[model samples]
Target: QLDAVPSFRMAVHPHIGTRSLDLVSERDKVGFETVLTSAKLMIQEKLSVGSISAHLADKYNLFNNSVKKQREDLLGQISSVESGKAATSQSSKCSHVVGHQAACCIKFGSNIQFRASTPEERESVPPPISKERGLVVREETCDALLALLTGLKGDTCKTLCLETARNEMKNAGDDNSLICDLTLLSFVRHCVEMGAVALH
Candidate 1:
């Protein structure tokens, strides 16, 4: 791509009168002028080429760095968006679990209220304390039920169980055959109290 170096040429100065000058001396003088002109042109051409090359290199480097920075900025934005999505997904899942737990707690409390209306209705159910073993079965049962609700994993099963319990209580009417024992009522009361405090 480079321009070829100009060939050296010999010529006599127009100002020098060839009529008065010696032919041999004129030829020598022309040869010297040719060499000087060739050397100056060559030096100028080399400097021009070097300057052009340096300018192109600087431009290319600036463009390359700009592209690299843009790519990094794009990747960083993608990472931030993905991280935000992950956090939102986790928050939604927690909210769903808390919602389920709150529903179960409310349902359990409602069932307790429906069962334990009067003093006689409460007293009719036998005490959970086993006289011989000293084991409180009602407390254990309430604890197990609370654990199930807290887990929030068995929605359909819990709903079915609650429905069955409510039906049984309804059928018992004024009889003492209802399963809303005193220990479960106490557990429900405790949960309501705790929930109230948390809200405050």
Candidate 2:
């Protein structure tokens, strides 16, 4: 059984307020990267599907157990508060005084707004490497082109084959999303050329 470490719990619940959910803390990043690395190793070693299934089951069980513990703790707190209120009401009745119901709602701040940071604020953190930035741009462009060529046929299929060939040549060095997308597009184009109808 996997233990529920604080870092993993933080990964499970990263958001604290109205922060961008897409942005994760360094701890969450570490946890996710660890899991991803393990999964990659499992794939490379040709591990059985049941091995991966069991790994996923453990993670899910951790999440479910954490949620259950939180629910039980919350209910216990509510019960204690209600009992305290009932005792207060009883004492108030003996003294012929009115008892007030205590509000037990939890409040969260909603005043935060999202915005791009100023250059000065961004200066603290170093920018991504040029190669990394280039890779991201290339990946986005390839994804857009793939979306356009999703349902290619006839003249469109030929045009996409040419485009995919060009992209594959340009992206041959890097094994990134663009290369994957181009490969998929090339496969689809070949299938269409081979009299296979593109459905949807």
Highest lDDT against the true fold, candidate = 1
Candidate 2's displacement at residue 146, Å, is 28
For residue 18, give model 1's deviation from the true position in Å: 99
- The runs of at least 3 residues in candidate 2 whose Cα sits more than 4 Å from the true structure, single-residue gaps closed, are 1-45, 77-200
User: What is the C-alpha lDDT profile of model 1 across 21-44, one tens digit per residue?
Assistant: 555466766776677777787667
- Computed on alpha carbons, the lDDT of every model, listed in order, comes to 0.40, 0.38
- Error in Å for residue 133 of model 2: 24
Best by TM-score: 2
TM-score of each: 0.18, 0.19
Clashes of 2: 0
What lDDT, from 0 to 1, does candidate 2 have? Answer: 0.38
Candidate 1 lDDT: 0.40
